[model samples]
Target: MDNQSLNADILILEGLKVTPRSSIAAFIFLLLMYIFIMVANIGLVVLIFMERSLHQPMYLLFCNMSVNEVFGATIVVPHILRDLFVSDSERYIHYIVCVVQAFCVNLYGGVCHTILMTMTFDRYMAICNPLRYTIIMTNWMVVKLSVAAWAVVFVMVSILLSLTIRLSRCRRFIDNAHCDNASLFKLSCEDVVINHAFGLSYSVLLLGSSTGSVTLTYIKIATVCLRSKTKTINTKALQTCATHFTLYIILMFSAFIIIILHRFPHLSDHRKMVSTVGEVALPALNAVIYGLGVRYCIFWYRSDTK
Candidate 1:
């Protein structure tokens, strides 16, 4: 059995190896990052809610993204902080808790990508079909899209979690700071054919669909913008789409790469550390990106000055 294997009661999480000084530094830094992520995401959400002027489908999509970031941070950051002070067998987590944690993290990822796709659709309508934007993206329609995205992902990841719960683990040591389906399944000694198939299929289909949908929208948006004779109009159109695309890539690229890395099964420790940190850190990065780049966010910042 592996040194960190599952006993009857607990599964060891030995993913992060940090020196005592580094652990304390990491804890303080992560705690601050988590707090900033929560405050920024929640603050933006509250700002959106309070502002009647910001009640459009576009803003609502941003709100959905923010809420997902907060949800992701909540599920991920506390455990990392806990590990800083608690070590060895005390670092072990209940199997059920591990499963729940994995589900929430994946759930946030799926939903966040879905929300990005939705936002892209909103932008496409606004920029490419400006006259019909209002008529097409009604509040009722927005609510349906938002709810459907969350509901569909909940079902998808729920099935994933259900499958994970039934797996026979020969080893239970997760060598990372986070709980994920891939990490948990690494401990399995049985045939993982079905596990691999379904997991790979689900990830490929979901992420492929989400990113594909967004990319296609941007491509179409770009094509339409290029036809415009006004240089300023064309530049502005491309710039706007580029900003949204950057956020999508920033928020999910690491996870997307990590998902692909699972196929290798021989991923380096450095790569694993980068992926785990990216998973936790991306939400905070999103907040920072939008806070500085989004026009209304800038407006809010300079309101006192004006």
Candidate 2:
């Protein structure tokens, strides 16, 4: 047999598990969720782009997050639904395609985490040092921060992709609903030491720094709130932080689920599938919580620029 025929079996994704009876239900559920998520994310992106009043640092940071939401979901979900609803016989994704999907998921997610970090700092400045916020978080600063987020993710995930993609496949099964770096790594028969080392170190550096910075800033903001005697001041402080705080919670929880899924393989495939979905796609959930809940959105249509 030629090389093409010999390597054919190794390129397949065999871990997708949906019972034939449930495939229809799964397809329907995922389709609906994907549509809702896309619409919400797209709407947010367009709203930010159209409204000049919304062209502040905070909205720019959130615009990056919202765009990533759509990008990540598009990378993962449509394929999943296609596989579930259409590909009854051949459920295997090509290995190269899988690698690309895995890369995009991480890239989008990494950028979102960084954007949230920037957003929290913006909040800290706005609430804790309202006078300097405008001077500090200028249009150029916002653009640079946004560009920096994407640049960091691009470099790190490129390293991860380099380390993981060349490994020899021991198995084709992925054991989840979509392609993930962890899922792909587990299939490799070769030593994944480099992948594990670089992936872990990079993840810790990126997430840990963001988490610590955001936490410290929020703590400072809380102190500022406490220092103020006016009840309205405290309420406003809490309100300003509310959406970003909620975004942090949701992103962190999704990350926690990914960790649990990897650390404890004893968990059912069903659970892994759910956690997997939560990781790559949350625009619908976030739209309800952040977009609708934030007061800025209420003023999106108003001609007054703050």
Candidate 3:
């Protein structure tokens, strides 16, 4: 009994040691980054809600994106900040808490991706089928689509979390700073073949389906733009889609890099840093990129004052 207890304590200490101690400068840098992300994302959400002129579909979707950013960053950054301030002895989080945090973070992040894809489709329809845009993308349809996105996210994340939490973490050390879902699986001593298979299958299905849909929509939109006789309409369509295009590229590339890095464990530290920047820092820049790059946003702002 004494030996078993001592082994358990050792495992717990090993898990605690996974997160490296940060210097004062590193702590301050992380704090500043968190604050910047929070302020920028929250400020965009507020601006969209308050500005009556910005109540269009595009802006509404932007607001949702902003909200998701706030929720997603909060899930990771608060724990990171706390870990920085506290010692390992004081930093033990309950296994249940870790699982819940991982689930929520993935849920919001997935929802954000789905919403952005929907927004891209919405833009495509509006630009390519202007006369039928209203009839097709009705308020009712928008509401239903948004609700369905959330529903899918909830169902997928719930299943993933259920499977993850059932695994016994006998070897408690996690490689990453936070209790990431994949890292948690790595720490588990139980047979995780089922969990790994399901996770990969779901990810592939969801990502492939969504990417295909977004791609088809944009292809049709581009074709329409090419054949259009009206240069003004063509310009407007390009302007409207520019921000969404940039967002899609950023998200898809970042997600791809992260998954690749996670799978290929032998990748160097520089590669991991790139992935982190893609996932975390890129998200923080979304609002600024969209706002500055989209002419419609500027037009709405200027016209509102007049």
- lDDT by residue (208-262, candidate 3, tens digit) is 8778978898899889988989998887678778788888778878777767778
Q: Which candidate leads the pack in TM-score?
A: 2
Alpha carbon lDDT of each predicted model: 0.79, 0.77, 0.71
C-alpha-based local distance difference test score of model 3: 0.71
Q: For residues 1-306, what per-residue lDDT tens digits would candidate 2 score against the true structure?
A: 787655654445544477889988877877888888888878877876786756778777877887888888888778776776545346777787888888998897788788888888788888888899899999998988889889988998888888887787778777666777888888888888888888889888887988898889988998998898989668756876887788898888777677666777777575568664684457778766656643455553362445
> How close is each model in CA RMSD to the real structure?
3.8, 2.7, 3.6
Per-model TM-score versus the true fold: 0.89, 0.89, 0.86
* Global lDDT of model 2: 0.77
Ordered from best to worst lDDT, the candidate numbers read 1, 2, 3
Q: Is candidate 1 or candidate 2 better by TM-score?
A: 2
**How far does residue 234 in candidate 3 sit from its true spot (Å)?**
1.6
lDDT of 1 by residue, 1-306 (tens): 753554643788875677887888888888888898989989888877886656778778888888888888888788878887887667888888988899998898889878888888888998889899899999998999999889989999988877777877878678767788878777788787777788878988887887789878888887888787878667556655666888888766786677666666666466567765775678787886665545654464467458
- In model 2, the number of clashes is 0
